[model samples]
Target: MDLEFMEAHLPLYIEAAVLTLRIAAAGILLAFLTGLITSIIKYLKIPVLMQIVNAYIELSRNTPLLIQLFFLYFGLPKLGVVLSSESCAIIGLAFLGGSYMSEAFRSGLDNVAEIQTQSGLSLGFTRSQIFRHITLPQAVSTSVPLFCANIIFLIKETSVFSAVALADLMFVAKDLIGIYYKTDEALFMLVSAYLVILLPISVIASFVERKVRYAGFGDTSTVSG
Candidate 1:
């Protein structure tokens, strides 16, 4: 298994893990923000903007992430729009994750009962106030678990960043295998790293989902199509 070689390269792998986390974290943040904005626009049925958002969601969700990354990393340069590999990876992942997260957010927004909005309006609440005080809370509660799951998916999906030669966990593992020819050890470490990060997240999401469901925030039938 080339234990000595692994030990010698442990620091490099750790650095790669850190980079992976950085990219994933940044991409997730971007995705959440993008998702929320688009979801809200769609929820409000804002004319041209809604069409644009829908188009983006359809295109991003329907396409492979690898193609998106390649377009940004390679295709853009042909048009003189150069981007670094890291930039391409982060943007690609964010767009891909945002598309899915937007759906989750849309589901949550849809779950907020129409009567709740009407009641808030009857009580003299403006639309914005109603949304801020009533609809948003319920929507967020209902959507939190799905949102968490989406984040975990993106975390794993970050491995694809290696295709662009970005030095993330998968890339580092592949590099180590190339150098030491210790395929088993490299794959083990790669899988272990992902499990270590993802297991706790999945557990926490499950616990939170149960609590939210028990608290009546989750009613699967009300979730959007």
Candidate 2:
């Protein structure tokens, strides 16, 4: 490994990593909101909207992020909707991540017992009130592991932002490799950059997951007590 070359190129990688993180954070936030709303719609089984959400989930999950980015950055301009590359990247990541997040949230929501909901209903709690006060908290707690996994997955998916001309870490690495032929140095920096970003998140997520599990946050039986 060329330590000198790695040190020289570190700033480029850092800039790219920052861009990547910003894009990932925006995408992840949008995805979480989208997932939460869609999951709630599914849970409530709203007639027309439920079918639409189901189709969106299926389409988003079934397609590759690359294809989605291409459609956003390239195809949309043909239809008179011009989007910047960064916009395309964020939208595509959200489009892809939202489906996965929806599934995670839906799984959590499903684990809440029907009896608990019924008990709330009998106590004169509105449906929205029950969800806000009881269901949402338990479901979110139960789904922490899944949420962490999805966030990591979405961050990694930002690698494809290069396809939309975003100067993400993957783009910088590939550019350096193509221009300077320093494949080893470029790849080493890329890996290290990702490790810096993801390692702490992975460790923290594991710690939080263990804490939630130990606290019995998702145990359906505890609902009665």
Candidate 3:
């Protein structure tokens, strides 16, 4: 173990850590939005669209991520789906996140009472209006915290982008190991980098979950619990 080399390379590792954070952040945000939309599509069972979204969810969640990256980075361009590595990570993460979010959102929507939609329709609200005013709000509040938990998950998922040679944290760590042969140190640094990116998200998710619980998802009273 070259302590000197490790010390000399700390800055490089930190830079890689920052890049990893950026990648994870971008991917998680995109995934959250995409996932939310797909979840709604599935929950509503929108004719042909719902079935497509269901298939997408199953496919994304069921596949090994390494294969997905290979397909996106190596295979897709065979059919002309070209994207930079970082861009591909965002797209891939969003695709997978959307699929998983659909399941989370469907569960949340199911938690809402069927009567709520009926009452809104009886009050002469259009289907879209009822969804917009009555159904969606409750569904979103119910799902958001859970979705936030998924954000932490999605952040960890971003580490897999190293397969495509994305300079995410994992890639950087592997590079360092290759250079210094301090495999343990490199692996430790990688794990620490992931923790730094993910811990705050978990904490924030917990806070939002508390807020949602207080909002009386069950009560449906004033917006405040």
RMSD list, candidates in order: 2.5, 2.5, 3.8
Q: State the number of backbone clashes in model 1.
A: 0
Clashes of each: 0, 0, 2
The reply for model 1, stretches above 4 Å from the true place, is: 211-225
CA lDDT of each prediction against the hidden true structure = 0.86, 0.90, 0.76
Off by over 4 Å in 2: 122-124, 214-225
Better of 1 and 2 by lDDT: 2
Best by lDDT: 2
The lDDT ranking, best first, is 2, 1, 3
lDDT of 3 by residue, 1-225 (tens): 566766776787688777767777787777777777787777657899888877887888999767887888999899988878888887888777777777777777776776777888889999999888877777777787778878777777777988887776777778878876889777776677667767887888898888876325443443223
Candidate 2 local lDDT, 79-101, one digit each (tens) = 99999998898899889988899
| Residue 131 in candidate 2, Cα distance off native in Å | 1.6
| lDDT, candidate 2, at 121 | 97
How well is each residue in 20-138 modelled by candidate 1, as lDDT tens digits? 88888889999999999999899989999999999999999999888999889989999999999888988998999998899999988888767778889999999899989988888
Order of the predicted models by TM-score, top scorer first: 2, 1, 3
